[model samples]
Target: MTAPIYVPFQHCDALRTLAVPYGCGIDTVGVDPASAAPAGIPEPTLTPGRYLQEIRSAIRAMRALHDLLPPTA
Candidate 1:
């Protein structure tokens, strides 16, 4: 089976412009759930339940999009 095409971070804007022609949309995930403790940065202090919920939501969104795409050729 062919793998899903992966565009680098720098090329994201280009992908957005080309998405229409390619019949695909971009999905971005910027959060790192593994980092529970704040590292000098102002971040939300989510309870374990909330953290897991956020992760589940993101995964659900991605999976939904993946299901819509045609299988790799």
Candidate 2:
């Protein structure tokens, strides 16, 4: 099987920043989800289900932002 793509921490941070309007928390955004469970990252103080819900909410927000932005020239 092919190896999983590993993103650098900086890139992960950038993604989080872009995804913020989607409802991602400042602290959670800093975390690399791929690395979180493996690196013994602590569970988000929030419930797992709630975290996922917020992520979904954030994605919707991002989509709205995309729709509102003018298309590139």
lDDT of each: 0.47, 0.48
Tell me how far the alpha carbon of residue 70 in candidate 2 is from the true structure, in angstroms, after superposition. Answer: 0.7
Candidate 2: what lDDT? 0.48
Task: List RMSD in Å for every model shown.
Answer: 9.6, 10.0
Model 2 clash number: 1
Q: List the residue pairs that clash in candidate 2.
A: 22-58
Error of 1 at 9 (Å): 16
Backbone clashes counted, model 1? 0
TM-score for model 1?
A: 0.41
Best by lDDT: 2
TM-score per candidate: 0.41, 0.39
* Candidate 2 local lDDT, 9-55, one digit each (tens): 33344344565446554322244454556566564556678657656
Q: Give, for candidate 1, the lowest lDDT window spanning 10 residues.
A: 1-10
Q: How many residue pairs clash in each candidate?
A: 0, 1
